[model samples]
Structure formats: structure tokens, C-alpha cells
Target: MPTHHIVSAFDEELKYLANRIAAMGGHAERMVDQAVFALVNSDHGLARQVVANDEFLDIGQREIDEKAIVIIARRQPMADDLREIIGAIRISGDLERVGDLGKNIAKRVVAVTEARQPVRLFRGIESLAELALTQLKDVLDTYASRSIDRIGFVRDRDDQIDAMYTSLFRELLTYMMEDPRNITACTHLLFCAKNIERIGDHATNIAETVYYIVTGAQMPAERPKEDKSHKVTAQATAAADPS
Candidate 1:
């Protein structure tokens, strides 16, 4: 016979943790979207707001972690209960990283606000950001609904973001090569693109965490990567000087 009172208290604690993580996920999604919008529109005010909002996500993650730890110590959960606690901890950490990446993109937007940037560059970045934000929103929805079946779908979509990023990287590099004046803005955009790509990765991490919580199994393996930035860079260097 399980202790009804203790189990009830533990259930409440777990629910609280889940709610906190969901809130953090929401903040992260908004921040990422706002940061990218600021970049595309050169809106420094929005970028600054995104930067400020990241502190809230940091606090949320800490609170979730503390609450999860207390639940573990008090309830001494086992099996499925233990998985739930650990999953919350892992998801919150991923959410925090997502916040940080969004913050990075926001910072870049601020840095490039005064610089002369090409509209095509902004277009490329906007496209990449759109895909990343979609993945983030889908994964968060999946987590909230506790729908494990959608985990693989979200996981598979990350590669699309990676491929988009790789394409943007090459396009930016070509712009820099064509005109040295474009280097400063292109460099900042490159960083912003990388940050957005990383946000997609964090979303994938959360998806895997959800999978673990549901199935009690580690994700099969690292998803096959489609990011070819390094290879493209190497090829560009070799073509520049064949000796």
C-alpha cells in the first residue's frame, strides 16, 4: 500500500516542476522569435528587451532545479517517479541553453544595428530563424502534451535547420569575399545564424529528454548532422590558393 499523503505531495511537486519548465520553454520561444525579428528589422529596442528577458529564464531554470532536487530528497522517488524528476532537471537545463542562445542572437542584433547590412543577408537569416523557431515551438508543445510519438518528428527536423544554416554560412562568406565592407555585418549575422542553429539543437535535446521520460531509454544516438560549415570553409580556403 503506497503512502497516499506522501505520494500526493510528490505528485504536486512534480506538477510544479513541469509547469515551471513549460513557462521557461515559452519564454525561450518568445525570446528567440523576438531576437530574430530584431535582427531582420534592425530593431535595437526589441533586441535589448530580449536580452533583458533572458534573466527571467535563468531564474526559472534555477528554481526548477532546486524544486526538483527537493522533491528527490523528500520523496525518494523510484522508477517512473525518478525519471520524471530527472527529466525536469534535464529539460530545464536545455531551456536555459536555449535562452542563452537567443540572448546571443539578440546581442548580435544590437551589435549590427548601426552597420550597413544587405537585405539579402537579412532574408537568409530570417529563413533560418523561421525553421528554428518552428522546431522549438513544436518540441515545447510536444513536451507539454507528453506526446512521445512526436519526439522523433521534432528530432528529425533539426537537420533541416542545420542544412539551412550551412547554406546561410556559405552565402554570407561569399558576401564577405565579394566586398570587404560587408565583413563586419556579415560576421555578426554569421554568429546570429549559428546561435539560431544552436537553439534548434537545444530543442532537439528537450525532445530527447521527453523521450527518456516516457520510455526510460537514452536517445538512440546523436542525430546525424547536416551542418557542413567546416567543410565549406576548407573548400573555400583550398580554392583560394591551390599551391
Candidate 2:
């Protein structure tokens, strides 16, 4: 076999892997979008559809896994080539988890819809999901572009998603505390919000994967994270208020 022909085959295989990952990324992002829309709108059917679409991501991950294993065995890829293929698998795992998180939120739509809560709370969740989804798209774009230039920015925005989720957490707790009737719905919303936050985390994971594939170096020891929901308490919030 001609050396150039072998190199061409290798390049084509890598391209196929990247294209598949990009397709999965878009599908996962859409699932989250539709899931959040359904939750906010109380659209049970769309929520169900989002749940159903999760299987596509699952299948995509499996296909990528098989294709990557074949490529590794056939090509005996090393160094940078190995990293690219391995990175795709890692990103696929993250994307699959993101899809699972979206499905989890979708499953709660019925429960959240049953418990009456303020419209503003749902709006807050929608806003947070939007931010996370945008960042997810950005990180996926970085992966497809094969550029590390935008990865740092995408990674930094994960903090903003955390802060937004934390803010929504406090607001939901305040509503639940103010009215016992709101607890059921607010609790479900809290879970949904956490899922969105986790999606942001997955986006960051993809960004890190992109950085590693491009630069062959791990990100710094500590990445910015601002989620404070676990530490928050109504009593502390009230005590800290000077107004």
C-alpha cells in the first residue's frame, strides 16, 4: 500500500469520528433545549419526545465507541492521532451524560407541572438553561473548529452558569419556605436547575478535552467554579441581608 494512501485513509477516519461527535453534540444540545422548553411550558408531550430522543445520543456514543476501537486497532494511532481519537470518546461520554441529565429533567416535567409555582421561577430556569446551552454550543464549536483559542472563554463561562443556578436555588428555597404548597414544585425545579448546572459542567469537560487534544496539556489544577447552593441557607441569607 502506498504511504500516502494509508495517511489518507487515516485522515478520513478521523474526520468521520469528528463529524459524528459534532452531530451528537448538536443532538444533545437540542434535547436539553426541548426538555427545558417542555418543563417551562408544561408541555408533557415534548418532554416525552425529549426522553425518547435520548436514545439517539446513547446509540451515537456506542457507535463512536466501536468506531474508535476499530480505528485504534487498525491504525495503531500514536501520540497526537491517539489523543484525537481518545478525546472523541471522552467527549462522547460527556455528551451522553448531558443527554441523560436532560432526560432526567424531562421526566420531572409532569411532577413540576402539577405543583403550582410562580411563573418567574420557571423563567429563571429557562434563562439558566439558555446560558448553559450557549456555552455547550460554544465548546462543541471549539471542538469542531479544532481550535483552542475559544476554549478558555467557554470554560470560564461555566462559573456564570453555576452562579445563575445558585441564585435560582435560593429563590426557589425562598418560595418553598414562604409557602408549603410550593415545596413540591420548587424541589423539582431545584433538581432541574442542578441538571442544567451539570450540563454546564459537561460543557467544561468538553472544553478541557479540546484543550488537551490541541495542546497536549491539561488545564490548570483549579478551574473556576461558583456553585454555592450546597452552602446556602434561608437563615444565613436573611441574617446577611442589611436592607
Task: Report the Cα RMSD per candidate.
Answer: 3.6, 4.2
As a whole number from 0 to 100, the lDDT of residue 1 in candidate 1 is 14
Candidate 2 RMSD computed on C-alpha atoms after optimal superposition onto the true structure: 4.2
Best by lDDT: 2
* Clash total of candidate 2: 0
Q: In model 1, where is the ten-residue run with the lowest total lDDT?
A: 234-243
Question: Pairing residues by index, what is the TM-score of model 2?
Answer: 0.92
Q: Write one digit per residue (lDDT tens) for candidate 1, span 9-79.
A: 67677788888988998999999999999888889999999999999999998998899888888878888
Tens-digit lDDT track of model 2 for 17-72? 99899899999999999999999989999999999999999999999999999999
Clashing pairs in 1: none
